[model samples]
Target: MTRSRTAGGGGPVALTPSERAERGKAARSSVRRSEQARFEPGPDRPDPVAILLEQEAARVPELVPIRRGRMLESPFRFYRGAAAVMAHDLGTAPHTGLEVQLCGDAHLLNFGLFASPERSLVFDVNDFDETHPGPFEWDVKRLAASLAAAGRDNGFDAAERTAVVLDAVSAYRLRMQGFSGMRVLDVWYARDDSADLRAMAAQGGGAMLARADKVFAKARSRDHLRAFSKLTHRVGGRLRIAPDPPLVVPLTELLDGGGPTDLDTGLRRLVDTYAQSLAPELRALVQRFRVVDMARKVVGVGSVGTRCWIFLLLGRDDSDPLLLQAKEAGPSVLAPYTAPSAYANQGQRVVAGQRLMQAAGDIFLGWERLTGLDGRERDFYVRQLLDWKGSATTEGMAPQGMRLLARVCGRSLARAHARSGDPIAIASYLGSADTFDRAIADFAESYADQNERDFAALADAARTGRVTTAEG
Candidate 1:
């Protein structure tokens, strides 16, 4: 693979196997720094519960109506409310030296199915914008909390919900133990496809096989061309994006009617950065497409305020359209506890982490800094916005299916951690699944309570006119 030079004349240096191993060791050493407490004294602010309420007040406008409606309910209201609290706990949590590319926000909802390079559906952690090197416990805690909350929403009793949370953690711990027994390359080469996963689930008493089958079917039905066709329509002779207010908007609204808009310039710069980020062959493959239009598209609850743009690119013909997403980068919630990244650019952090975690990534993955209309410089990484993606719906899943889904998420997370972390050390720390699972279950239940209090606080703020709620 041809190595592309950085924007200035200094090109990236290629590393030999030994050199790469040395770098990995150095990275691991940096992560070891996180095991010790480095809690900085800052201004005393709201408690974790209060902080969560404030965040919810800010996030309320961005949530879809369906999610918003759920928030109106008690426990569901609490889960949305307690995100910041969970973040706070994670920020101050105890750590082990073993570190991988951590998914800073490892909520249950974040796991999903996506197409690999081989066109097979695989289940894995789907979001990495908040990824950083930190204590693995933080991710485990967050995932557990999300599962507990999700279980509540699914109408499971408290004990049953606790069991589900424990099972998820146990799966992660056991999988990490298994990974510790494998050769480094063997662990790295491991990939899970739908068929294998379904088989595994089937072996586990047909736990999640049916739901997995449904989600896999839905995801495999979606591909690049199908996605583009669904999102684009012909307006006269020109291809234009169909607008869905608050969620999706046309590019014209985001740009001035000049030769090229601010978005266009930002996108071009981002593409150039992305080209440098890719391995040589992938970069060359991406060069064939010419960017035509871009649109600002809103996605996910936590990511609503952040700028996310979908670029429409043209290949040899109009029929060959590719959609890429460039989402703004911000400080990782884990930054307060984790070692500071060597890379200054948050987008670069995201792009680097995604490449390290995924077997094969989108060719267009890149990052650039853009000055918004308000003169604030925002960093962003670009990738295929939604190419053959789908996830198991927690709401509709049966208890057994949910348990299996949690296990799949846990195992996949462990695999990712194993690839980038010292599996033997991590496995040792995790020891038995029982203790870790119980710990996570405890944390999840406590966090869910915190979320409720926070949600109420947000509701109170809205009721008292501290924040405004958008009407559907």
Candidate 2:
């Protein structure tokens, strides 16, 4: 495969299968590169925190209610704060050659439970819209920092917070080591079902078992039928979305701004592209359904300004409905660090990365280019956005619950990395859990401080009217 370089002053390069194999082999051989890079904090370069804030400030006018709603939520506030710091640190950090497909924002909150293709609930890294190949340490650092931040939110003392983060890092290290010992097929087959997780928690002989059971219950409660029941309402034999401010609103209202009638036309065209992306069996299954209600919905903090749509499709019966979400795609946060995607469309990058990371993704996953109301061409990917998805509550989890959650995240992350990484070499580099745990613990504390500084800056900007908060 030949790809044109969009960054740097480089020309097109041909990457043959053999050359690709060689690159993977080289990456495997150099897996311990992260260990070689001393983990000292780097001198600040251009503050990515400030840069991100400036970007957000530009979008604030367009993202009034949704962004304000997210900022008002404490956990969401902390997440935004942490993201600013991570982006800052990453902008300044020295290179560790060990790179893999990263969940650019791999915070503890991002890991969750979703249904696998087999209709069994499995714990996994649930979001990958920002996926890109980059230094593996970035993901580890972000995850560790999130643990500390979460602990702080739960009112844990510094010592307790350290212990929680250390335990999580230890689990991540040990799981990676375990994967190194597995055969390729075994690693590929490896999955963490609710039963397996509960059993592991029981074996840990702590307060983890009860917490694991609670997590299992939450995961099980998020099936397709349950999700549909919660989001849809029946009105005279028709299925319709219950309108909610910011999060959900009718399509007619969204198109009423006199922005463009083509918005609806674009949506219809995108749905056809989505249908074509599905596997034959799934496509056939979906073809039986008729589109009933559609809405424009806003979701997530960082993704507030992007275009997102939800469609309610009803089968022969009103009770049989499926909900799908289509989200716009832009350049990845990791784009600066890794090679630019060969595909011109960012949505294609997202779809490809999801397929690579998930064993069985929504068959309807796909992308298309559409001209928006502003006459800007945008890329979008469509999927069964929330069929059976749920996450452990991080707000007030007991210390033991945090530990169990950490292990689940660790195991899931290992499985994700193992899919595209050289697990054997990665395990070898990790060695024992001790050093890895300590390193991440140190990074987490330092990064948390960075987050605080950035949060204060944001507050200052809001006060000074450089960036207007909803309160302003």
Candidate 3:
């Protein structure tokens, strides 16, 4: 299975499987698995609140409070919105230099079930806003720490949380071990569809399998039509998006009595340019539908204040509806720590990284750069607004339930990293022992403690009126 292929940089160079394995062994010597357990905040660590404040400078003024409020809800919620803070902390940490496209904010909630190009429910990393190439362990640590924080939110004691974190790290170690020995294309094509998930769940017990089935059924039910019905209504016999205010605001309300077409014209232009980024088939498929409606949409915790929008199109009458979301793509949160993306447009950076890491991506996935309604140029990546999307509930999850979910998440992350990284090297470094898993589990507990202190900083800022916050 040894073949010459370039790993995102330089020319193709031949390296035998054994050579790759030796590279992994060398990395282990440089950074021992037991050393992965070390995590302690330095005295010079940046102020978490100040980092949030700096981050909000590029976001919409009115929406910044909403972002703060969401982060203020809980430590886990804060963790969700505090990717920048974590990025800063990670800067001071050590890494193996085994690079992969990181799910820059690879928290537990970021992993979910979505419809693949083949229309099957594939479980994989669902967020890419902060994705970039960096040390593979960064993403793993992100996921591991998230489990610890979420466990606290769900009332799990320290021991239970550590055990759950171990389940994820162990699954990742074992899965990478398996991938290291597989053929390259075999590793590239590997994916965990519904059947794979069900099989894995079956071994956990009937209760776990039933829970997985429930999540699968829920994902299967959420398609474009379902999203259209929930988010649209007839206004003067013309379909338009229903305003949920703050969270979902129609573009008309933001126009300030300006000409109706001014902003709509800008959005249409965005769509036109976005179409160019798609394949000829998708471009033709998209041209068949007229851009009917578009609105400002605040999505996800960390992405709340970004320039996110939802566009509605109809073809072959109202029954045939397509909803696409154009989300603003900024620099990767890991950009400062690793290296700047080679891409000029942030949207393209996201698209390229996503295509490299995900088993499958949305068919309509594309990117465009446009002068927005504010007369500012912005980068955006477009995809379906909603298509068979669902996630496992972390709140109130039992210890074993979390452990089962962790196994799925850990393996899922490994599969993603394997696509873009040297799996043989990584597997060799991890070896066949639980040493790496236990070390990471220890790091997770320590990081979770640091996260709580950061959460308290934000809380204090809100109480002192140092940062404005609003109800979501």
**Best by the lDDT measure:** 3
Best by TM-score: 3
What C-alpha RMSD separates each model from the true structure? 7.0, 5.2, 2.2
lDDT value, residue 369 of candidate 1:
73
Residue 379 displacement in candidate 1 (angstroms): 1.1
Candidate 3 clashing pairs, residues 3+ apart or interchain? none
Give the per-residue lDDT of model 3 (tens digit) for 1-472: 3444677777677788888888888888667899999887878888999998988888898998999889888999999999999888876687787888888999999999999888889999989999899988889999999999999999999899999999999999999999998988999999989999999989989988998899999999998999999999999999998889988888887775466675678788988879898899999999999888888999888888998999999998988999999998888878888877889999999998889999999988999988756678889999999999999788789999888889999999999999999899899999988999999999999989999999999999999999999988
Ranking by TM-score: 3, 2, 1
Question: Model 3, stretches more than 4 Å misplaced?
Answer: 1-12
The residue pairs found clashing in candidate 2 are none
Global fold similarity of model 1 (TM-score): 0.83
Stretches of model 2 off by over 4 angstroms after superposition: 1-44, 47-49, 57-61, 72-76, 80-85, 204-207, 234-237, 257-260
Candidate lDDT values, in order: 0.69, 0.68, 0.90
Q: Which ten residues in a row have the lowest lDDT in candidate 3?
A: 1-10
TM-scores for all candidates: the values are 0.83, 0.86, 0.97
Superposed model 1: Cα runs more than 4 Å off: 1-84, 204-208, 255-260, 371-374
Candidates 1 and 2: which is better by lDDT? Answer: 1
